[model samples]
Target chain A: MLEIKNLHVKLEEEDKVILKGVNLTVETGKVHAIMGPNGSGKSTLSYVLSGRDGYEVTDGSALLEGEELLEMEPEERAAAGLFLAFQYPVEIPGVGNMTFLRTALNAQRKARGQDELSAGEFLKVVREKAKTLKIDADMLKRPVNVGFSGGEKKRNEILQMAMLEPKMCILDETDSGLDVDAMRLVADGVNALRDAGRSFLVITHYQRLLDHIKPDVVHIMADGRIIQTGGPELALEVEQNGYADILKAHGLTEAV
Target chain B: MGAAVQKSTLEARLEGLSTTGFAPAARKDALARLVAMGLPGRRDEYWRWTNPADFIAATPVPAQAFDDSDEAPVFEATDRVKLVFVDGVFDADASDDLALAGVEITRLAEAPDLNWASGLYGTLEVAGQTPVARPLAALNTAAATDGLLIRATAKAEKPINLIYIHRSEVSDPILHHVIRLEEGAELTILENGPAGARFNKVMEVDVAKGARFHHVRVQGRDHERRAATAIFARVAEEALFKSFTLTVNGVLTRNECVIDMVGDDAVAHVAGAALGDGASDAFLHDDTVFVTHGAERGESRQVFKKVLKHGAVGTFQGKILVKPGAQKTDGYQISQSLLLDDDSQFLAKPELEIYADDVKCSHGSTTGAIDETALFYLRSRGVPMEEARGLLVLSFLADAIDEIEDEGLRDDIVGRLEAWLNRHRD
Candidate 1:
């Protein structure tokens, strides 16, 4: 469902290159886990795919369901079923959480030429989804993540993923600030959406998240490129021996 | 700076204007003060940020009335005692019956007996004249043609809403109002509409011991209109006074609020939200506020927010003064502006003076643009760029809008703000 062909990216304001000749592809209905050390350009790939600013694509292209995502605006990418779960959710002080979600849903619907959902209808559906994710009614009524805790924010992201029902989801360090219980709750939410029609790109440093939302394929990314590809066992190898051994086997000498 | 030239300046401005004598003593005193102070100019320290030329011009500059037919009249369906004014004249036929329980309403145009209003009409205006002068308010008191004199003796069942309508292209209207609440009485006043081509208004409120007074106003009319308005209020012991104004799309607007907390444990809050867009050099908004704490344990808060674009200019001058004996006073002031582009500008001056050492007071001012990270987050959620920016702008004004006591009135104001943002979306 998602494909990347030799995506080369660099910081727009700086001369440093981040993703140097990176290529990857995730088939339909599959979960791909990318394991990398710090500053290995894993997050840059997700940002470039989601059409975030501050990054210039020097060469190559990213396609989502055969549509070029690099040429589309962020909202258009979202309407075309590309979702990026941010590492840091924004805090909007005055916009209510429910209103923000409803606006997003209706906007995507309008962009897709679908009828908008009424307030009442939207409320019923949101309440049901929020219940399974353990988000309380007060959290939904408050301003969008203004005073939410880490766990609540991550869960809120999962709730958006579920509501949007995107074709391909990219989890960019979603487990960074979450506790173990929060991680389990978030993984359960992601696991619930696993099916034959949706694909996910799980980016992480540890294999703990993969143990919950088991991936079908695992790839080791080093120096802005995938140097090793294997099954789920590869995640265990990286967790057990660290990237030092992987880098050594790949004829590279870099400590992580 | 000769006395004769000052007199001529005042005379030229007040030419061809006559009104029914409401409070002869107060009006005479106000005229004397206006003559002494003359009119504000760009050289004045208080008027440096915003020139008073439009307000001081001899003849009202003509303005083509803004077409607001697409918007529903604010507070039209609310349950309240409605009073309508056209070009500063009271429209008895267009207004509801001037009778309500627990309150007394007197029209200034009828030359009615001032009764309790005789001493309280311009008392606050005169008292607030020290240290700084507000000559425009003095002019309004001296030349205003008509307004309402309302006194609430008990808790009122409904709000008192005054709606102003503009129909003349060259109407120059000056209106002065007096509001008094007796001990333990409660009242809320709502004012909206574009009054005239050039509008000058002043409201003086007397909140008695333990009384509560709330005022919410919307200064909107034709986009080309120019207005200068002032509110002078005195809060007694244990009394509460709150006033908020929302300004949208005027060539020039200056709203000044002066409040005095005279008794212990009194609370006062003055806040405003202004949105301006200037295609030329016509849009400028200024808010000048002064709050004084004179008693023990008094509390005062001033919150003002502005959103400017298209080279529109906004200015804020606010001060909080705590007297020598006003120990345990708590005062807070904040002024913030969101400039949508490089062309827009915001100027703010926040001051705090504490004669008492045992008081807590803080003031802050900020000018910034939209948060780009937040913008990207919203866009990633599939919200269009314009709608996302509009949402953020409304959020920036939430602090000022929250000062309103009524939820319905708050919703009405939000609806109008949203409409303004949608129309100005670029």
Candidate 2:
């Protein structure tokens, strides 16, 4: 569902390389987990794939299905079914959450040459999707992410993912600020969206999130490269023993 | 001295004026005040940021009337008493029947000698001139040819819509409006359109004890049109006064608002939202506001915001004053601007003066570009760049837009802003 080859990235404003010679692929309907310590280019990879600014791709290419994702604008990439759940959801004052979601859904549909949903149709669907995430009517009516608790914000992100139904989804530390109950709720939401046509790339610092939405494969990333690729047991192994064993075994301790 | 000052600046500007509105005594007094104050000049402290050369010149710059009819007229869907004016001339044929007015309304040109408005006209303008001078408002009071004189003794059933339509390329129009609300009365005034190539307008409102007044105005349509507008309002005991203005597309514009809370517990709020793009015509918009709290427990708020791009310029000067005996006064003022590009400029001056130490007053001004993180967040959610920027701009202007007390009017203003954004897409 997603492919990357030797993806090298650097800061656009300075001479700082973030992602160096990184490559990964996620097959259709599968969940892949990328675990790493701080400053290990995991979040940077997610940002680069989402077409965020301030990062220059020195070399390499990322493709969604067969289309080159790097050449497209962020919105175009989104229309092509790539979604990134941010670590910190932006707080946009004066823009209602419902308005933002409706606009995004209709915009994506319009870009794909599909019919736009009517207001009534949109309201009904949004209400249904928001219910499972435990988001009430007031939260939907309020401004996007403004005054929202950590649990509410994470749930809102899952609601968005459900509504857009992207082909490839990237969860960037979605569990960092969430409590245990909130994390389980978020995992349940993601687990519900697990279908044969969707792929997940879970980026995290702990294996707690994986315990809920179980990954098919886990890759240990360090020093801008993926040095270890294994199954779900690998995440437990890293959680039990820190990235030190993996870094030293790969002779990346000095780089760390 | 008055004659000498008038001849120096307004020699040719007032060559063909023979407009007599209200009583002779009031008109004569306004003329005398205007002549004494004289036309504003570049050296004047109030006109330092805006060049009054074009306004002082003998002839106005010519502009072709814009003929776009793609969008519906503002407030067209709402029910209102329509009063149409073409280049300062009241169009009797286009206006509705006077018998159908929801409130007591009279034309300034046809008002009787002992008219109710004659006693109130220019009263607030004169009172607003203590700390700073507004010579243009005095000029409108003295020289306006025609306007509407509105008085609401009870809650008005419908709003009064003042529709100014521009047709002449070189038309320079001056208009004066006077409004009065008796005790416990209520009224809402809606004004819109580009009056002419050059326009000068003044509105004076006296909100009596327990009365309420709401005002919403939209300025622009002609890119080359230039305008100078001023609103002076006086709020009495427990009265409520709220006003909001939306400005777009004009080349040079200045809006001055002065509000005085004269009686205890009175409340007043004045806000403005402006959008300027200099890709075609130069854009300059200045909002200068002063709010004074003179009675105990009075509250006043001044909120102004502007979005400028492509070398456009925005300026804001806002002040709040709490008089000595005005204890427990609550005053809040904020002026902000979003410059979309390096060439755009935002200038702000915010002031607070409180004689009563117990009063609560705060004033702040800010200027910056769009929040990049927020912009990216929107785009990442599938909104296109232009659409995302428009959303952020609307959000930035939302606070000021909310000052409009009516829901339908607020939606109409939002529609107008959205249309402007679409037309000026990056």
Candidate 3:
């Protein structure tokens, strides 16, 4: 459902290339995990695919179901069934979380030429989805992520992904700030949204998140490129042995 | 003692007023004050940010009514006793019978000789003309033709709504209103509509001991209108005084509020929300507020917010004064503006004068564009760019609108603000 070929992206304001000659694809119903250390161009790939500003995509193309995703605006990407769970969700002071979610959901619906949900209908759906994620009424009422614990923010992001029901989801380091319990909870939220038509690109530094969400394909990314690709066992191999041997085998020295 | 000064065009306009009818004494004193101060020039300290010359210039700009769709003025949804004024004259035929219980409303033109109102005609304006000069208010007092004299003996059964309609294209309306809330009395005064092409209004309020007064005003909607309005209030012992003003659009608008907390343990709050879009080249909105904590344990707050876009200008001049021996006084003043784009501008002057060692007074002013991160976050969630901008703009004004104590009234004001945003969004 999602494809990336020879993608090259660089910081727009700086003379540095973050993604170089990267190629990846996640078929429908597949969960792809990209494991790499810090500055491995993992998050850059997510941001580029999500159409974030400040990135100059010099070469290659990202496609979603045969549609050119890179040419679309950030909001257009969202309406095109693309979702990115931000590594750090922004806190909007006066915008209630529930209101933000409803606006987003309806905006996407309107962009897709679908009827918008009434207030009552939206509230009912939000309550049901929030309950499954263990997000209480209070968390849904406060300004988006303001004063929320790190884990609550992650959960809120998951709730949004579920509400929007995007076809391709990108979790950018979703487990970085989460504790073991919070990681499990977030993974469970993502698991509940899994279906035959949905796909996930889970980016992380560690393999513990994969243990919970269970990726179908594992790719080891280093130095701005995916160096290796394997099945689920590849995550355990890196977790047990670390990336040092893998780097040596690839004839590259450790970054540090 | 000295020879009478020469008159400028604005001064000549004031000089031509027919003083044969109203309180000639008050008009004479006010006219002298205006002449002494002369219309505030751009060089003057207070007028540096907002000039009255364009508003008070002779041969006023030819009036052209802004064609807003027919909509009910705010408070039309509420049960209020409506008093209509058209072209500065009281419209008795369109107004409700002045029979509100616990409240007495008299036309200033009919009762010009009444001692109660004449005593207060220019009292607050004169009292506030210390330290700084408000020559335009003095001009309004000297030239005003008609307004209301309201007195509340007990709790008013319903709010008194003053609706000003501008039917004349070239009308230059000057009006002054005097309101006195007796001891233990309570009243709510609601004013709305664009009065005329060029409007000058002054409202003086006296809240007696233990009285409660609420004043909510929504300025005219005409984008080409020019207005200079003042609300001067004095709070007595244990009384409560609150006032809020909302301005949508105008060529030039200067709203000055001077409040004195003269009674022990009294509370006073004055707030305003102004929205000026690209309605005209010189769309200017100014709010100049001076709040005084005179007695012991007095509390005062001034909250003003402005949203400007498309080269529009917004200005705020606010001060809080804590008098000596006014121990335990608490005062707060904040003026903020959201400039939607690169062209819009916001000018603010905030000051604090505290003579009491035991008082807590703070003032702050901030001007900034909408948060881009917040904007992107909303847009990323699928909200359109314009709708996202609108949401953030309204959120910025929510704090100032919250100063309105009544929920229904606050909602009414928010609705008006939303309507303005919908029309002006780029």
Candidate 4:
């Protein structure tokens, strides 16, 4: 469902390559977790996939559903069923959350030749989904992400992913700043949306979130590239022994 | 003198006081004081943004009798007590007497020279007298036409509404209205501008100790009309003064408001929203001074928001002043504007002058286009671009309009604002 081939990205100003010759592939009906330390280009990969501005894809292409995703604009990528749950969602004042969500959902629907939902029907669906996620009604009426707690904002991102129901979902540090309860709630929301013919690329620094949403494949990333990939047991190994073992196995560790 | 000089003098006598009821000696004294101050010009600091001299150069035509045969007001709140004035004369048939116990609604000409009017007239200065206002205000004082003077006595409970309506097509007609609220009095006034006429009007408000004065000025006029109105308010000890000025239409309109917090613990809230299109020019200037002399705490806030499109021009200037001994003073002024089209322009200046070391004063001014993310968010929801823009613009102005305590008046102004947006959306 999603493929990244030698995805090389560089900062616009310094031209310093961040993602160097990184490759990854995920089939439909599967979940892949990308575990990386800070500055490992995990967030860059998500941004490149979603077509955010300012990241120069120096060399490489990202394909979603066999379509060239890198060539599409942000909205177009969104319409084409590619979703990136931002690490830090932008706060938009004077724009209600419900209004934004409905617009995005209807926009994707319209792009796919589907009828738009009326306000009443849209409200009904949103309210039911919100109830399941434990999102209060007042939160929906507030400005998008304005004055929301960190966990609440992350939950809102998950809510958008649920509403859009994209074919491919990329979660970037979705567990950061979340309490134990919030982390469980976020994991539960993602789990409920899981199904065959849908894919997820969960990016994180720790293996805690991996416990809730089990992944079929776990990849250890360091120095802007994926150094190793193994079965789900790799995550438990990294949690217990840290990345030292992986770095030593790759023969990249400096001499003491 | 000579025969020709005698003829000229006879002609001057024939003119018989350009207007009526003006005491020559008093008018002369006021005119002398005005002449000394001189007409406010572009060089004047307060009049820097606005070229009062240039505006007065055109010399708007003098006040003339208006034809009252036109249709009634395009919109009027049914619950509001209405007062209509044609030209500079109050229309008795268009006004209803308020038999409310604590309220006194009468014409300025009918009342005795009260101490408040004597003290307020020509005493408030906004960046020195501009050439335009110097001559115009001097002329207004010289002519001294009839004006509405509404008073709410001390401890008055009910809110008194004073509707100053301008019904005319005259060019340079000037109208003056004064309001006084005694200690512990409460008053709410709704002042409406001319529908399709040119005017230069001034209103002076004196709020006494512990009084509460709420004013909402609604300006929804034709685009061809030109107007410049000023509202000067003096708030006494522990007094509360709140004003919301809404401008939806006009060719060239400016509403200048100055609130002087003379006593401590006085609070003032001055908010304005100007939405214009099609060569319309709307400017709102709020100059507030919070003086915390005896009372330790005083608060003043000013917020002005404007939406401009289709070559429209919007300006917001807010200044807050805190005196030397006025410690613990809280003053905040924010001016924001949104320009919808390339041709539209906005100018905002938020000024803060504080002498007291312990005072908290801040001012902010920002001009920008609508939030693209918000816009796309709305459009993606199937709302057309224009509708989305209108909704955002309305939301932007909602902050200022929400300051209005009167729900009906707020709705009326909002409705007119929406209509203006709908008519001007391209």
Most accurate candidate by lDDT:
1
Score residue B38 of candidate 4 by CA lDDT. 58
The Cα error of candidate 1 at residue B316, in Å, is: 0.4
- Candidate 2 lDDT by residue in tens digits, A1-256: 9999999999999999999988999999999999999899999999999999999999999989989999999999999999999999999998889989998999999999999999999999999999998999999999999999998999999999999999999999999989999999999999999999999999999999999989999999988989899999999999999889899999877343
| iRMS per model in Å | 0.7, 0.7, 1.4, 4.6
TM-score of 4: 0.76
Q: Write the per-residue lDDT of candidate 3 for residues B319-408, one digit (tens) a residue.
A: 998888989999999999998888989998899998999988888889999887778777777788887888788778877887889889
Can you give the TM-score per candidate against the true fold? Answer: 0.97, 0.97, 0.93, 0.76
Q: Tens-digit lDDT track for model 4 on B204-286?
A: 78888999999887666444446667777788889998998877656567676767788888998988888777653443322
- Which pairs clash (backbone N, Cα, C closer than 3 Å) in model 2? none
Lowest summed lDDT over 10 consecutive residues: which window, candidate 4 chain A?
A: A247-256
User: Considering summed lDDT, which 10 consecutive residues are worst modelled in model 2 chain A?
Assistant: A247-256
Worst 10 residues of 3 chain B by lDDT: B11-20
- Which 10 consecutive residues of model 4 chain B have the lowest summed lDDT? B284-293
Writing each residue's lDDT as its tens digit, candidate 1 over B198-274 gives 99999999999999999989887468878999999999999999999999878989999999999999999999999
How does the DockQ of candidate 3 come out? 0.59
